[model samples]
Target: MIGVVSNSRHASDYSQGVRAMADFARKCLDNWVLTVNGSFEQHQKMIRATLAKRAYELFELRGREHGLHLEDWVIAEQELVHHNLNGNSSGFCILVDCPRDPGIITILSVTSRSLLVFQSRAMADHNPELIAVHLLPENIHPEQTAVDAVDGVLQVHLPKQRNKRRK
Candidate 1:
């Protein structure tokens, strides 16, 4: 993950913001070791907690209105998930569950508005490769983005681009 950030405008230029995942793999294979405790269940729990807090806030905002609990929860989920996907200026985090093993290689590409994951070695015999592409909500600061893989999960921190204020 130690490489010069490129300034290329090409869509394939994954090196512009985040260091290529290939570099991470190479370093890990050589000597770099990352020890982190994370899992898909943990990610789900956090999401639920966030949703609950947001729903409660919405309830309070509505003057503590009754009989709209389900509605509030739904609205909160929509807002948070949409905001996370659409790109809020405050940024967001995404968690991906992936197996961590020497035999598997995961190639990832990230840009200002999207994330692409391609697993070279499929975990199952029926599938030769696994590919996933996610569209971001809005433009992001690729350089400020961070990604971590721990305990069969990947956590990507996407920082939204700051608006330049004119004086």
Candidate 2:
């Protein structure tokens, strides 16, 4: 009877594991469908909502100042854009998992002007910093490039430079 009980318990555990795996698979499929079906208009609406929320938070953080609403909105929009560029689900720090070794780096994006955003953890055990350096092209406008660190992830945006046609 002991052998029978052991087999039954093992089968129960196996079934529970299979159910968990199925649930995870279903969630992944749902997320993929949402991502694929999400329209540009929908994305823009979401961005606008995020900007509004961030602007409100900024106002609250500043002790609810009466004026500077436009300034707050602009800053909040920029902040939200930067946060989204970091590929974070929310405007929060994303913990990057890496093997316990130095010199491991991941390049997130690179522009035509060679401007790039790469992720590399500090080599030192103490005071580890997530380093992201943007190399700007000499002809590129400085204002066009924005660098921000969010949730240990570095985001660098480099707008394409427009070529001037001379007659």
* TM-score, per-candidate, Cα-based: 0.44, 0.32
In order, what lDDT does every prediction score?
0.51, 0.35
lDDT value for model 1: 0.51
Q: Summing lDDT over every window of 10 consecutive residues in candidate 2, give the lowest-scoring window.
A: 26-35
Q: Number of clashes in model 2?
A: 1
The regions of model 2 sitting more than 4 angstroms off are 1-34, 83-167
Clashing pairs in 1: 85-137, 86-137, 86-138, 87-137, 87-138
Off by more than 4 A, model 1: 1-89, 122-130
lDDT per residue, candidate 2, 45-143, as tens digits?
Answer: 334554576788899999999898898899876644332223222122222223323343332222232322223333322211112222232333323
Error of 2 at 125 (Å): 36
lDDT of 2 at 121: 39
Question: After best superposition, candidate 1 residue 135: deviation in angstroms?
Answer: 0.5
State the number of backbone clashes in model 1.
5
